[model samples]
Target: MADTGEQFEASASAFGYLFQFAKALHICIEQWMSGDMAWNVAVEAADDIEIHQGAGDRRLIQLKQRAEGVRMTDLSEDLWKTLRIWAEAAKADRIVLAETRLFLLTTAEIPEGSAAFYLPPRGSQHRDEERALHLLREARKASKATKGPLPKCFEAFDNLDQGDRPLQSPLMSRIEILSGTPDINEVRNALQGLAAFAVGHEAAQAFLARLEGWFYNRVIEQMQTPGGRPVTGSEFDEMLSDLQRQFRYDSLPIDPDISDMSFDPSQAVDQQFVRQLGLIGVGSERIELAVRDYVRAFTQRSRWSGENLLRAGELGKYERKLVEEWRSRFAEMAEELGPEVTEEEKKKEARRIYRWVDLEARFPIRSGCDESFVTKGSYHMLADELKVGWHPDYSARLIALLEPARTR
Candidate 1:
């Protein structure tokens, strides 16, 4: 398995893309709302923006996206400090612009408990922080209005210098329709789990195997062209040796190491390699299919049929208690198995546990240990384990499983 550095790099890139996407989306929403042919919009902060409307008013908009629900703790104190400074500057700039406004836009409406503090801008610092305090009170009202219901849009605007027209018009319809930032936290958590598995035993081996397979494909691809310099047998051997040295798995017996744990071959194998080979009319697809079949057989064989009994509620209270005790013991055994276990075996165990946890977490059985189990393995092992029976075309299944759980 590879180290955390690669995974961290990948996640960072993904988050960066998400941030850019949010910024572009914010601009799109502004264009859509204002219907103005020309407007100056800038994403001034990660979760906030500054927009100068075509109508010639300076507006500051803050956007927040909370997937699991927003809380008071979700507001960063540093962000508040920054906002305080910005507000002061914005107020000062109002002297030049003749109109200035601030707006807070959120994906999910602010929760009632935290709503009091998110409203429009208040008076200058010298006056009662009443303007800021009033801003909070207005935010609380808005939050209450949108609770448990998704609003079409949300916006708050102020007129700093002009008494003739208020900032309310620009905000009323514009803010609610804007899409919140993409939820990067979800991907981060997923990557964290994957990284943990990479450090484990069986999963690590499987991951290495997948990586090796990927490298092998790259070599083969290079070899096939008419003028291409094919990889010599010695070169291939040397590359394998180098990989083994890098991963420190050359001394281990591949089969026993992977098999002993509960490696899900279907998950661990990189199907993309096989698919690419198939497109080239190569033999890799056949080999991959065979490997997948073997892995599936191994996983099915390792699963405890007894655990299915937990779903029925057929066991008496005493019997149920006994089962829980057995599960605890099994978990302990799994932990011990990690150190002495072959990498392959560790992978298998890790995959089975990871799949079980994933399924349980998504479905949430009322009374079961499925969600509580842990999978431990190296990066390769974890990836393979996570791949359990997952077809390359499993997106439909995932959507089917998740659709019911999503809030409208």
Candidate 2:
């Protein structure tokens, strides 16, 4: 509901410090992973604030610390901004920045309302600031609660580079003790492993579902007749192959589970096809009526198969009636046209009318990600190549439709 641009700006500012904290944590984790006995991990961007530390080549170990109000989904903005700033800073601090390997360390799971940060600007800066403050406080409290005694191994490095000792001395003892153990590695490995498993399972399930849907649709297509007649076995296969060839789907493999199932007798013809036919200025309704009449004629003929004469008569009578009705309607509409209109003008007029009707009948499909309809505008231009058209006034209309009335 908020303006996306405004949301981004506000969220961006509030998460800036959090991003710095995450970077520091990542550095500590990496040192821990490398089995370093003595290492210095400090948030040394604008200030040298010690957050965490561990021993040798700790790049493999990552740490992610977040405050209470920070939502899991909302963390991405902070993460991306942190990376961007780090990259810029790294470029400037070439002498100080020695490592390229960075890992993510987190103690919190992504929370609900986390997605708020990703929303469009909605002028909610005050709210976002409040959330960020809450998260920072929570994170600090969590860190303190989980704090352990300084590892004895880091005591030696406590005196390294005395000129910078004053600022780093307080954290040295704690960093050394923590770095000596493999607790950080255990935690990081467990979280990463679980995440990888969940992602893999989800992807596999989605792939299977898509495959099943395709197979089912193909099987249904083979059993149904253009005129609703039932077909079986070899007859069905032949028809299916022909249909596939017509649709340029010859390369698709046939699945036995779906290949033999009979078509649903209750299924009606798709209205989309009917709409397409109408787009060319054809009398869709008249065509439908004619088709229905033709089917009825066939039904009656089927009842008396031996009597060809009777069937012929019935078919002829229905055909003549359809023709007569069509001619009458055509003549009446033609008479309404001005006498000055030429044959070419009428054809052009029909085309224009058909196009207008088709456009009016078309509706855009909404995307799940942004809750916006597909359109040929800026959004579509930046989206995937296969873009769909969305209503021009959809955003305004949707907002109005969802607006709650104010109480007196």
Candidate 3:
């Protein structure tokens, strides 16, 4: 989604920072992994960035990002272009192909069958170039469903001289693909990984500060050139806003979480999943706390946190209990409110209760953390998934909630 070129300039704007952040992470991590002190990233016509470890140890790092889940079909064209750049660099003696690494860093994971296409189906001892070319041909032949020029480019490359063939005839093992769900957590984790190798806290802080400044400059440059039309200061401001809209947690100031603890599924908004959590004999107060956390996170548009909350609703029986317990409480409260509460008011309460039972029944809570401490981006999901089936009268109220103007 981030790399889709057909988007209007406004839509593609966030990519400026998304891409730079990923590149910076790769640079720091690569430096740590390779123990290469003298390296410059995103320099001198290299793809995304170049990592020069030594004479023959130069590497090309290409960063690709997708806003949604990635598929091989989605990558073909961009992959071709990146491959071409590296292949030409190798051919021109600008870098040694064998010693250089080609890293395809993305924000989406490659699906099962797609992994084999990146290589020769896992087990073949064939050269990477031949394998890359073969996949390219087959991908093109089956390209009726795809949309791009990658297949055609690969076709032409297959016909070129061995030296000029970027992907069709070569022996290179330094190809790697790194992908993950795009979120502040991803960026934070990357920075955390780089922390181990940083010279000190000051150095790490300086690197991040520089990266932020670099992103500001890069966005300005892209805004000015922007292919079709020259950009104005206003447009650059819009880009920054768009970046904040999607990656506010990363792009804005917030305390970072650096703990190595695993993600707690209880943080999700899944009703059934929360019911499962309830199975462990969690108290009502804890569930209420979790629900508040989940609801707040969802209201804040914390996508990853919402996913976690939704996961809780996946287990059937547990969610049912949660829904029943919540509805039962509402019924008791309605009785206490007595006859002044119309049947309509009773059902309205049911709708509200049902929405909660369905969405925000679970929230992330780990040991030693305060009750009010909810992670940024922690949210609810599975709003339609009530532990108990919907009642017709109550459903109307829920529908009304969805369409506020209907009643007003």
Candidate 4:
């Protein structure tokens, strides 16, 4: 079992990570809306979040959040730690000073007469790089004579300021401290405000949830790659535009996750739709595809219903159309077969009907619901309920199989 202090530290660390991730997401949305097209955001690359224009210019941001009313004093650990990381990066040439801007965003406020207090933008009332540098130099001197993390931070800071190199001047000049920065909730509200332009008030919550879901997944994909391209502003814009088009009056949302979902035919082999395919002598590979479409359609419709994207009796009406179309096709196939059909001939004709439904059928639930799975899988769903089937004798065959269990 872990000690109480260790547990507290672990929980605090987890909270810090959550805040950092949330902050990164909030920053991405803001930059996507207004930042330059050339700049892209990278997570855990050069800093907590780095907005860079290729290999040349960068905005390295460090985020820190504390409990309410906590002021970032001159000797604060968060300030020193962030400075140490940036200083070490500069000293190591991992970042070029000439084309990089450093941002320290914190929920904590910096008081008057502090080093950070003088390090806001130049036009601010107390903005003074010289004064800030002087204060930092004094702080470094004081820290050098002490023990623990402070000395290490000051050592990194001093390393950049040493000799004729004097990198700290340019570095300090580029530093911008965004004190009393908005917390996570405020940032979420800001994102929702931006989402309103794409999707109106009623659908904003669902739209934002889905947009953030995609954005987070995209960020994770980028993070996992060793040296992948950063998530760009353009990608976010494209994704948002696509999602906006989905929410339009004629269209419905297609979940990317469901579209790419993996299917195991074995798990659904006993299902009625799979049995219907088997009765039509559909091959194993084709049966597998049918099961996939069925599951995707079922899950997608459930999502639509849960999200309230479908109207009252809308799905029933859609299914009725599907059943009606299948009925017409089945009747035409039956008439062609006549009363004197061999088992092999019936099987071949059933396969033809199934193929037509699989390859040529196109009944969109809505004018804009263009995902093929929704229509294809919904057919399998109807087949599952015996409302529609590819095989001409699927009902009689299924009833014969069911009657034995009923008698038992």
Candidate 5:
């Protein structure tokens, strides 16, 4: 029989670890947005998350997320374990006691008369640093003969307090117990609140999705590298600015998958867009470029349409604009050549017209849709449909070529 209960318990533990990461990310974003960019946040550094203010000053955070209604009592394991870690760090000289502020952020509530309850900020009604230090010392004494991890916890707690410049009072003074902290889901909601206003209601989800994706990728990279760089507030600001520009009313989000698509020129040799380029005496190199543009434009347009990013009839209007411009240029080229032009001269004129579309034409589907490939590839898309072509006699040549296929 399957042990479903054990499996679910293991899964829950995994989720707790994930929640720590999520909470750390949320805290970084919050601090950055609030203009506290001077500090650099590092995950799993001196603690679960460490915010460094330079000159050896730091804020170390330990996050404890528990089930609803759980309370941080005098003998709570979560309380003792957090104390042990901080005490060990102080004893090892890895942390400067005078320059460090410790934060214990938990989903659990702190009961009155508990060590944690008296360690809130001085402005808090329940705060009493002196009382907190006294309580911790008494608790350490009372647990002197306790077994399991309690003995080591007491030993570490004693080591920090026994030194010439006893760190107990200084450390207790700097510690802040932020009980009743928001859970993972609430933190996500807060992050959404921070982000949604920038992109508007309709596009808020997409904007946040992209932002979080970039953020998580950066986090992963940092985690893999030893002594990784801290994520700065300015970096977040810059990324937010970039995302804002992309999600603006005049701009459409460019799917990297479409724009960065790879293509094989050989594979598209039979494509009509390639044949159109050949009619204008385009070289293999230029034809290959044209094929690439065609694929990108095709894929991108399809993605935009499928995602409903385009307004109804907007693409049709843009295509009509391109075709109209091409028709005028083609007529002018035909008039210049007349009926007496040599084949070479006709091909030269056709290549000139093709160059104009590739180099000089500037038709954007939207004002901020400034990607050159989109315009270039869209022209190729028009050619592939036989609605626009460079060569004056391209229609005749294309019809003749397709007559065999039509017959079949």
Candidate 6:
């Protein structure tokens, strides 16, 4: 649940995608109606969705929604913008003013009511000329006061040498503010309307199935790749062309049988063997690393489970013993080597040797580790320290000296 408040602006942006998808589906039906060859389309196109017919006719929509309800102010700016864009499109001949339609579709109801803002259809009247004229007057007034889009649009339409001056040419006839209609209901109704065009029962079933699948896949794609800003008409056209070139989604394969699924021993072990190790008190952190290494050696794998969090307390105690014994041996050797090296420098060298040895022992090349990894140490820092202004053979000689003390 969400409200139409400013705090839910991010949620509103997310809603825009869903709204765009719905509008796109509706526009797809329009494409079918127009016998459009190029089904190239997208959401957030100029307004919400735009389509061009084979005969150069264009249809554009600006979609808006509100959680609670919509008002005159909420629609005023959008209407003004749509009028301006349509006028520009007409001026450039990008769309036929007589054939093209510019619509403001909203999920919320007009609080001041559509009757006042829009002219209602009466007996023997097919189109609402009064409402259309009222919208023009309102838009023209809005254009003057707001001094934004509508004014420039009116200018563009006026300067056009065509007979469409004073915003005529049936362009105003093409505009409609469809308010008080829910978006989901509109999409379903649009689909049902398409179902009317289906040939027979089987064809209708196939058509509905296709609609459902297409809706799901496209919506998932939209959700995964969300863009908040509205795109320009040229950008939308280019993107549509690119997508058409890249993807060939004309056919879908039949669903495969689930009973045929089976797993190999290697895959089974890769997935669960690490968990088994963890259950047996191999430290979770170490088992995790081992699983990662196993996958890196073979194929991809998921992270370890929560059930594999059990710690190998015994292995930790034993590793501690290993470190202590090595430290004792190092101390004795340093003491017996005469007073050439200070105790601090000797201890630092011993520490560096121990860290490198610890890493190698934990992740041995050939087989199983004697102790699992509890923590991931900073091996890179040790490597960097060794590389610092030291003799080239320093680390090699140190490793040779400490080889006798290693657990391996």
Q: TM-scores, in order shown?
A: 0.26, 0.19, 0.40, 0.90, 0.80, 0.40
Residue 83 shift from truth in candidate 2, angstroms: 20
lDDT string for model 5 (288-386, tens) is: 888888889889888777656678899999999999998999999999999999989989999998999889998888998888888899999888888
Per residue, candidate 3 scores C-alpha lDDT tens digits across 1-408 of: 545565766555565456555555444444545543454444223555555544666666666666676554534666666666665565566666567777766665565445324553224453254455565556656656444666545544454455435433452355665556345456655664564244334234433444455444653554455332222223333433343332222222222222212344455534543453343344566556556545553443343333232223333443344455556766665666576766555545544554554355443232222222243213223323432322323344444545765556
Model 3 stretches with alpha carbons more than 4 Å out = 1-7, 10-17, 29-36, 87-95, 115-133, 144-148, 159-167, 171-174, 181-185, 192-211, 214-408
lDDT of 1 by residue, 1-408 (tens): 657999877876655545433443334333534444445444433224555554557566554554455443223332243344333353444323245555554344343333223332343122223333455436434453443221211222232224654433332222221224335454334433442353344334343444335444543454355434433333434544443443332222133233444333356334432222222233444434434434533342233222131223422342344335335534654666755666455445544443443333232122232121212121112233333222222233444544676855
lDDT of 6 at 270: 28
**Least accurate stretch of 10 residues (summed lDDT) in model 5?**
138-147
TM-score of 5: 0.80
For TM-score, the strongest prediction is 4
Question: For each predicted model, how many residue pairs clash, with residues at least 3 apart or on different chains?
Answer: 40, 36, 24, 0, 0, 1
- Measured with C-alpha atoms, the lDDT of residue 27 in candidate 3 is 49
Error of 5 at 135 (Å): 5.0
Least well predicted 10-residue stretch by lDDT in candidate 6:
300-309
lDDT of each: 0.38, 0.33, 0.47, 0.83, 0.82, 0.47
TM-score of candidate 6 relative to the true fold: 0.40
- lDDT value, candidate 1, whole model: 0.38
Clashes of 2: 36
Q: What's the C-alpha lDDT at position 206 in model 6?
A: 39
Q: Which ranges of candidate 5 are over 4 A from the true structure?
A: 1-25, 32-37, 53-57, 130-155, 162-165, 254-261, 298-309, 339-346, 393-408
Report the error of model 6 at residue 79, Å: 2.0
